[model samples]
Target chain A: MAGSSVSWSERAVRLLRRMNSFYSAGSSRCQCWHFSVGGMEVGLVPPAVLKQLRRFPEVFSFKEEKRLELNPGLASYHDRSSAVDRVLQRLREEERFTCLQGWRDEKYEVMPQFSDPPLMCMERAATSLFGVKRYGVHVNGFTRQPDGQLAMWVARRSLSKQTYPGLLDNMVAGGIGSQKGIRDTLIKECAEEASIPECIAAAARPVGTVSYTYEDGEGVFAECQFVFDLEVSSDFSPSVGDGEVHQFYLWPIEKVKDALVTEEFKQNCALVVLDFLIRHSYLHPDTEPNYLELVVGLHRPL
Target chain B: MAGSSVSWSERAVRLLRRMNSFYSAGSSRCQCWHFSVGGMEVGLVPPAVLKQLRRFPEVFSFKEEKRLELNPGLASYHDRSSAVDRVLQRLREEERFTCLQGWRDEKYEVMPQFSDPPLMCMERAATSLFGVKRYGVHVNGFTRQPDGQLAMWVARRSLSKQTYPGLLDNMVAGGIGSQKGIRDTLIKECAEEASIPECIAAAARPVGTVSYTYEDGEGVFAECQFVFDLEVSSDFSPSVGDGEVHQFYLWPIEKVKDALVTEEFKQNCALVVLDFLIRHSYLHPDTEPNYLELVVGLHRPL
Candidate 1:
């Protein structure tokens, strides 16, 4: 299993680099690429920017450049002022360029408006808003109610989200590329997205990382996700971040699965949640539904 | 296991640098500090000569100098030049420097001589004399004897070796940083060290790497060795390189183990050969001989 994870990570890295190269040729300014190095995720800037950076001996040194090249997978950002202007023009047409006010909680904030290409906008949102691309681990904390059913806390995304607006996700899902590892990311995401407290996050135990590729009309995307299992008290209530998350729902596992099958859950929310359940063997053993096969094969015809 | 090897290599590298530093400071000319990059071996020049080298950009580039600071372990040479000169200055002192010469081929014209402080010889002879420190994979080839025993073909080191003169070693072993992986190095090392045909080297299969630490009275060294396994016809006769190697030896497993225990094998030769056997479980399963433990613990008393 460890070998498989390493292989997957290697493949993911290759795919990411290939994607970066493909996208880089089209943009005037190079995009920032992130990759795992020495178990830590770091961002690399484009060669053009790096060349300019070399001139500033005080801020950067050539010796440091040699050190960075030792790990070749790190990505770099290129000059993109013109590209940003073009992206901003597109944003004006969509009326989605309104700046958001900072939220009351210092750590929790709405995505800032960006006048840029959708891809550039997404990159900016991921960096300036979410910080960086990271591996996210999710744990499902649940217990049997008096009625003999398992219940889990789920967070709903705000309708303002550009993608998957008004959809349910894991109680905590964030990138591991952040300063912290999976546990820290989970706590931070849960607190900011669902308002889960430190006490609840502390009880979580990491299961493993679940990886999947997601693509829309925009571009290809990959995520290294982790899941943790936590058992919260029956009466546990989470304070949802109003600016980021809309509401919180505590539902039985069976009901979640039912919603997935009945087309009740939003977008790929059901599939993602179901994937987590099946991976952890939370579902009944005898019920061997081929949901993954169906979902994996489902693709919009080009 | 990989992490442990990295840490061990790092520690060995640190000790080696410290040893070089001590030798460098004691020398007047400071010429004894010669380091190579691309390959991590350091060459110690005599203090008087080393002073000339420090200012000679034609001989050593600035890049090589930078690499020395980054990876001190590659510093293979220490100004043992003065030591060698002192020994050569007196007939009795010359005896202190052990001498061994191995023929490169049947012509016996180009025999390479290795000394304790290695010979400061011509470039071609020097190249073959120096052990290129690099990563390598070890492979074990097998053949059945008429008596129903397994016979292994091992290379005999040249007599003029600084260490392990006239010792038997792996069928193939070479430094890794030479822009060659295990397969490539095996082919080259076998050809030069044992006179094996290129076709046979091509047929060898890499099994694994055997990493070990060696400390002589002078300095500590670490090697990332790759092991390979091959099967040959029983009638095959190894063509020995008289210029580099005196002769070839084929011994059964029992004789090999016996030689290791009796110390009949050359210095440090037993560890390389015996460790390969133990790691691959070639020894009888029922017999619990702690040969590796014994040899590894036999540290030189300060």
Candidate 2:
């Protein structure tokens, strides 16, 4: 539906393939070493990053199994957290990586799974460098027209943003930083990103998640977004808030689908929007030949 | 949350593990040979089934690379289909397998993906013998009470049914026989299984799909289900039709969650219902620790 020569499904698959580059078979990224902490494999370390870790012998270890792990002597959560933070701060001072240039003070929990107690917390911006599974909440805000058609609320990221500046995004999205709760993060993001009140934001239903892992020049990004769908009233309109967004538009679902394959949206945000379309039945199996593929691709192993 | 001793996430993970038994690490099933057709790997063959196929030298070929393929001499789709069906028919007559005893005069398309041109078609009942992928359509019929609570219509399979007899099921479900389209099968199943009218059944929205592969005593079942959600008016109630269902019950969402872990519903059908619960947010990420795992489990690579 989006391309004249290629079908929408092919375009969508291409987008997902881009987001899951690391998982591509036979790629060098597929050979990344497992990153473990406190006996739990929580992240992936590419060969290049592993080479850099060899320098921090006191804090890092390259075991016989080819795994990159923190020093077993750093037992307590506090000790591990500070040990990793020190290495990251020194790397930032040395200007060792371009991703470190966008460093934020935010912290993220490092664990095998979201519910498990974190072995430790690390700077949010550096999580990808270690390939730790990152979590975020994304809200699909939509309204039902009187004719029963659906329209989604789309946001334009601020030009001043560190990543994906000026690109299209979901109406509400924010990382689930350390000590943060999922729903509370969703509600807070809805208010900060789109000026939605707490009562309205509370209505955002936890639909599911969209997960994918890709490696760029910076590091590997393996992320799982807690997806929500909020059916806002037709009379409501969102205004930009927190200066993170430059503009807001209420576009028909068809327009959103067309934009998905054109790179008009931020890469991962497009995936979140694609998930919303599938769940709402805008992309039916009959029209989209890759319906099942698209569904499975959106939730590839994180 | 069904288990008092274990969390809902654990129970849900156990259910998914059961459905995806063949994918478990280091299991004998993980070593099943790739079953190929026309150079494409469309199915999987366990050692036991591979041994049986070797008896029919003219129909199946066991290559030096360990791949089990339909004889390449059967060049065309028609030739390939008839050749495989012949072996299945003989196996049925010889009482070689229990699954073939449920043989219906139905056929299923076999290919690498759902949208691809079929390499061949095989007896629906005997497909699992070669671990070929099978497809079906499942509908989640529900109604919103005046108080805003959601309830679902659940069917009890007729005692005379060949599979999972007298067990709980979705309001409507049916295998996608060759030449039948997904939405058409969904509408047809809705009318036949729940006595829902065409006009109402047409409202069923194709939300997404649930896929899994499991090995059992008979063989391997690799299945993908096109899932639909139909929200009926509160005044409408379903009655049994076609004698496939013995009775129907309108259950609250919570009741359905409880039944999922109890195995009250057929194994695969319960997965479809669990998917509905997740899409509708009856199972929140906060309470369901296995939320991400459950989401990924439902859409495992087929």
The top-ranked prediction according to DockQ is: 2
* Residues B1-302 of candidate 1: C-alpha lDDT, one tens digit per residue: 23334442233323333322322344322322444432433333333333333443433443444332113232333323333223223422323212212212111111111101232222221221122222344445557778876777666667876556677665555553322334566777767766778887676654323333342322223333444566678776666653566666777876665555332354334444554454333542112322212212221111
Candidate 2, position A160, lDDT: 93
Instruction: Tell me which residue pairs clash in candidate 2.
Output: none
Candidate 2's TM-score: 0.97
Q: Per-residue lDDT tens digits of candidate 1, residues A176-286?
A: 431244456677777876677888778765432334333322223333344456777888767676467677778888666554443234433443455445433354211
lDDT of each: 0.41, 0.89
Off by over 4 Å in 1: A1-134, A137-139, A176-180, A261-272, A279-302, B1-302
Cα lDDT of model 2 by residue, A1-302, tens digit: 44479877788899998898888875557567888999999998877778778889999998876788899999999999999999999999999888887889999999999989999999988988889999999999899998999999999999999989999999889999999999989989988988999999999999999999988888899999999999999999889889999999999999999887886789899999999999988888977899888898899878
DockQ of each: 0.01, 0.85
Q: Write the per-residue lDDT of candidate 2 for residues B189-218, one digit (tens) a residue.
A: 888888899999999999999999888878
